[model samples]
Target: MKPLKRILRILKTISLYALLLIYLSPFFFVLINSFKSRREIISNPFGLPDVWSLDNFVTAFQKMDFVSAFVNSLVITFFSVIGIAVFSSMTAYIFVRTDWRFNKVMFFVMVAAMLIPFQAIMIPLVQIYGGLNLLNSRWILIYMYLGFGSSFAVFLYHGFIKAIPLELEEAAMIDGCSRIQVFFRIVFPLLKPTTLTLIILNVLWIWNDFLLPSLVLISSSNRTLPLTTFYFHGTYTSDYGLLMAALMLTILPVIIFYAFLQKYIIKGVMEGAVKA
Candidate 1:
């Protein structure tokens, strides 16, 4: 019996490591290949670089216009997160606190909107933005993000708000505070966990988005990180070395940020999950 148990444990450990390597193989390939020269990469990508070169990363920075793209991504992501958090929180609070007929209907409509696919609406979105003269502007992306993101954000907030105590707000009302004052001063502060979750999710979406930004951004100068990487794939061919280096640079920040803040983000999600 003891020998059988030990054999099972050993097999489980081996299986776990196998799965880990399978998931991480792409990163390993990218890291190893990034060090190789374009010719060496093409010849034997699986092998180590004969001579390590910073040239791929150095060249990518210049050709990819990394600085401008980074700035554009930062600006778009920052505003998008803020807009999603504030608007969704406010909307959620109103709907959750009231029993109004219209508010209930509106909540269902918002949830239904989440079922609509982005591809189905992309043509109409482009047309609307064109008519509104919002083409080629970063704000257009932010606006679209807020509209698309609010449904989920509000959904999260609504559940978390129910779990929060209503007595605190009632006490503030008795102290002559209006509903607005009670919300910001009393209830909003209690929603910190949910807000953090919303911020993290919205940031991730806005930061890594490629399709909409590529379509809307008119110039290479206005490109985000993902859009900037497109130049790596030329019509005739591609520079795989520089492309991998740029890919590393683009993802490093997001990985680092999530690693540090993921604890709070996880707690927020768990705490805010609506129990049916």
Candidate 2:
């Protein structure tokens, strides 16, 4: 029995490591190739760089106008995440705390909206906003992100808020705190873990999103990192080393953001699950 258990444990460890390698393989491929020359990358993509150089990164950074694109991404993601977290948490609180039929109906509708694919409404949404001359603006893009992201954010917040004791809010209200005050002071602070989780999730989504930004932000100056990276590919040819470097630059920020806050995501989800 002991030998069988030990064998199973060893097998499980090996399988887990295999899965980890599988997931990380593409990133490793890109990282290694980014340091190689274009010719080297084309000839031996699977091999390590014979002479690792920062030339690709330097050229890619300048060509992509990486600073401008990075600023655009940062502004859009920061505002979008803030709007989603604030509105969704408050909206979820209303739905969870109140017995209003309208709130219940709205919550149901929002959840139903989550099932509808964005691709289904993508064209019409763009056409309408474009006709109104609302496209190409960061604020407009943030508004659209809010609309699209709210349902999932609300759903998560709804479950988490439900787990919170009603008495806490009631006690605050009785102690001279207004409804708004109670929420901001008591409820919102407690929602930090879930909010951080949502922030990280939305940051990754809004940061990497190319299609929506491509459709909306028509100007080169307004483009995000992912959209700027598209310039690396031409009609007949592409710079693989530079492209790989640009890709790495695009993903590096979010990777660092995720690494710092990743523990909270699990903590938030587990707490919400248990509470719900």
Candidate 3:
């Protein structure tokens, strides 16, 4: 019986590893194939490269102008993230702490706005962007991101805020802190985990977004990293190697960032959800 149980445990472990490999094999394939030359990729699709080369990386950079596009994406994502976190945090605090006649009405309105589809408003948004003379600028996209990011961020913050006892702020106020200082100094620090979650979530969404940026940013140089696939697809029509290399480069930064920060993201999400 002991021998049989030990064998079963080993088999279960093997099966778990097999499932993990099955899920991750696609990424492993891309990472390996991105280094292979065009001919080698076509001739031996799943095998190791005949000779390792950086030619595809060079071509992808030159063809897609990867560096400039990445810079545009980073800048747009940064501002959008900051604006969303600050606006949403302040707004959520107002909703939670204030005693206004319209408090409940405003919260319901935010919930309703979350239900509205972006497609329904795209035309109006485009016209507004055009009117602002922001059709080819990153700022338009940043603002749009703020609008979309707000609904979710507010909900998360609102939930997390409920778990915070009001007496903490009352005690701070008793100690001579002003309303703004009580919030910025005391209540705000307690909400750090939720804010961190919002930052990560908004940054990921704004960074990987392609459709909105495509519509708002028409110029090649102003294009976001994901949108750079426009010319990459058109120009490298027959070269799968170059296409895959570009794809890999675009995904690497996201993967690296998530690898280090994912612990905090998960912790924040769990704390906010469970405590709310």
Candidate 4:
């Protein structure tokens, strides 16, 4: 029995390692090709670079207008995430604390909305906003993100908020705090873990989103990193080395952000699950 268990454990470890390698292979391919020349990338993509160079990165940065794109991405993601977190948390709090039939119905509607895919509404949504001349603006993009992102955020916050004791809010109100004060001071602070989880999740989604931005933002000056990366592809040809480098630059910030806050994701989910 001991011998059999040891063999099984070894097989499991090997399987896990193999899966990790499979997931990381694409990223490694991009990283390797990012350092090579265009000709080398085209001729021998799998081979190591003859001479590691920063030229592709420099050219990609210049051509993509990296700084402007980065700032646009940052602003859209920041505002969208903030709006989602704030509005969703407040909505969840109202649903949890109040016994209103309207609140219950609205909550159910929002949850049902999540079941509808963005692809289903994509064309109509774009056309409606475009007809209004509301397209191609960062503020409009952020507003749309908030509308789309809130449902899931509210769902997460709803479960977590239910786990918080109503007694805490009652105590604050009894001690001369207004309803607003009670929530801001007592309930909101306790929502830290859940809020952090939502922020990171929404940041990753909004930052990497391409299709929505492409439909909404028509101007080059307002493009995000994902949109800017499209510059590497032309009608008849593409710059593979520059494209890889651009991809690396576009993904690096979110990768770093995720790496640092990854632990909180599980922590928040676990806490909400256990408490809910």
Tens-digit lDDT track for model 3 on 229-251? 76688877888888889988888
Of candidates 4 and 3, the better by TM-score: 3
Total residue pair clashes for candidate 1: 0
- Residue range 1-276, candidate 1, lDDT tens digits: 699999999999999999999998898888877777788888998888898888888987887789999899999899989988888988999999999999999999998887888898889989988888888988888888888899988888888898887888888899999998888898888888678877866776778888889778887778888888765555214678887788787877877887998887676556545421
Sort by TM-score, best first.
Answer: 1, 3, 4, 2
- Name the regions of candidate 2 deviating beyond 4 angstroms: 1-8, 265-276
Instruction: lDDT for model 3, please.
Output: 0.84
Tens digits of lDDT, candidate 4, 223-248: 99888877545521467888888888
Please list the C-alpha lDDT of all candidates, in the order they appear. Answer: 0.83, 0.87, 0.84, 0.86
Tens-digit lDDT track of model 2 for 1-276: 699999999999999999999999999999999899889988999999998899988988888889999999989998999999999999999899999999999999999998999789889999999999999888899999999999999999998898999898998999999988999999999999888778766776788888888888988899888778776555214678988888898878878866887887566656555543
Q: Per-residue lDDT for 25 in model 2?
A: 96
Q: How do all the candidates rank in terms of lDDT, highest first? A: 2, 4, 3, 1
184: Cα error in model 4, Å: 0.5
C-alpha TM-scores of all predictions: 0.91, 0.86, 0.90, 0.88
